[model samples]
Target: MPVHRQPGPTAGATSQLWPSGGRHLWPSGESSEVQSHARGHLVYAANGVLAVHTERGTSIVPANRVAWTPAGFTHQHRAHGDTDMRIVFLAPSLARLVPDRPVVFLASGLVREVLLALTGPRSYDPAVPDYSRPARSRLLRVLVEELSEAPEQPLHLPEPQDDRLRAIARLLHETPADSSTLAELGKAVGAGSRTLSRLFHDELGMTFYEWRTQLRVHHALVLLAEGHDTTRTATACGWANPSSFIAAFTDIIGTTPGRYRSGRVVQDQIVVAQDQEQGSDRP
Candidate 1:
């Protein structure tokens, strides 16, 4: 069965599934229906960008990051551009090595290579030339160990539980370009600025301004992935100028929007080629 319907005529898509996991090619603005699985899985976007949304919140997966979804959590995925998404499901024993909740980890070079290898054809094939179960297990162990050594990224945007906070969040999410101050937003939500500020810190572990900035950056990522120009994305995401937007985006994403757009496709293609070469050379 098809994992997802083709995006549209303008954008091509394909899905291939094996025993351990699958790959999905999604165009910008494509989204999966809400779903869950029995086993925990890791998702990586070799190209473009992905947003993994669950009850917990949304996690952004870029070329250099991996997003984990624990088993049994309700979630959906949306692609930000022409995305090459790879998924790897872990056995119960291996799943225990990761966190119980959904999280994002910065993928080191080693982790990226392992992820590509595990999702490549060699691991999917059950022939003598394919990776033995023990070899695959060792690779998984190395992946988990490397992940553990790196600190969790702030790429996850925590969902707010409080009613007032939720109301405020809804407004901001609906219009990321809105430049309303916390005091003004509190009035619209029927709460005092200080009270809303407290709610934001207590429930989301960030101040209202901080949370809003993160939200804007998230929107900016989606816009950029969809091929929007940097100045346009900056304006649409509430940044008054391109320089400020570039600074904030670089600070959080480690790259300017221009570079991210131009570089990710080439970088991902190179990685995929390396994986294919390595798999073909394997005994």
Candidate 2:
């Protein structure tokens, strides 16, 4: 009375699934980059972290996070340092049920099993729709419910809205590493230092220094997602040194820049270079 699972897709079959869809297992030190030309699929970071970014913003998806990307978002994704990853591409039809937002869900044991099954050959059965399977069905329900709930800890850094605060915000966004004091920023933005400090307090609800730190950290994340290493990313973002960058990144992102770079390196190893070379030779 025991259940039997069929062997998964053969190596040749998996190769065909590449460049479009498949379940891929990435051990430490494997990485890939991809540009989505068609509909953006649903992706789950089964383990480790996956960094995703677009013009709107950047987000780091920790283990168990579910990201729903709409079609043609122009984003890059990679695994976090020294961690294994299992990524499966959901079909376009199934992707519509979720919102076009990045969400990190608490993965239950049942959800974990369902995610594992998605990577197997059963997912490719033409006659068997992804949602038709019992596990898949349950997972869909959970995902919908979680999306409806607000995040326990919202992930966005606060932005200032007052006129003087807006000026400072613009400067920070444009040049995150510019080490100008409040007085200098105020003068450049046409406000007095005390006036700007009052505006920062009223609008952003944080000190000027605190708000600038948030901006710098967010900017650094964007650079890292683009495949820049810690040393370069830190220097470009205006940190005095790599250690300063690491401290800020760790404080805000809960991981060091080096670790973030390591994940991308792994993903790049697995997916980007060879694929691009192959495409170049095709013609």
Error in Å for residue 273 of model 1:
21
- RMSD versus native structure for model 1: 6.6
lDDT by residue (1-283, candidate 1, tens digit) is 1122233322356676766777788877787879999999999998889999999999988787899999999999889988888988888888898899999987877888999988776744444256778897899899888887766887899999988888888998999999999999988889999898888888888888888888998998888888899999999999999999999988777667888878663365356557866999999
Residue pairs in collision within model 2: 30-266, 30-267, 31-266, 31-267, 31-268, 31-270, 32-267, 32-268, 40-71, 80-263
Segments of candidate 1 deviating more than 4 angstroms: 1-12, 124-129, 264-283
Q: Write the per-residue lDDT of candidate 2 for residues 140-183, one digit (tens) a residue.
A: 55644544452322233454556677677777778887898999
Error at 191, model 2, angstroms: 2.1
User: What are the lDDT figures for the candidates, one per model?
Assistant: 0.83, 0.56
lDDT of 2 at 245: 81
Which residue runs does candidate 2 get wrong by more than 4 Å?
Answer: 1-128, 133-137, 144-155, 264-283
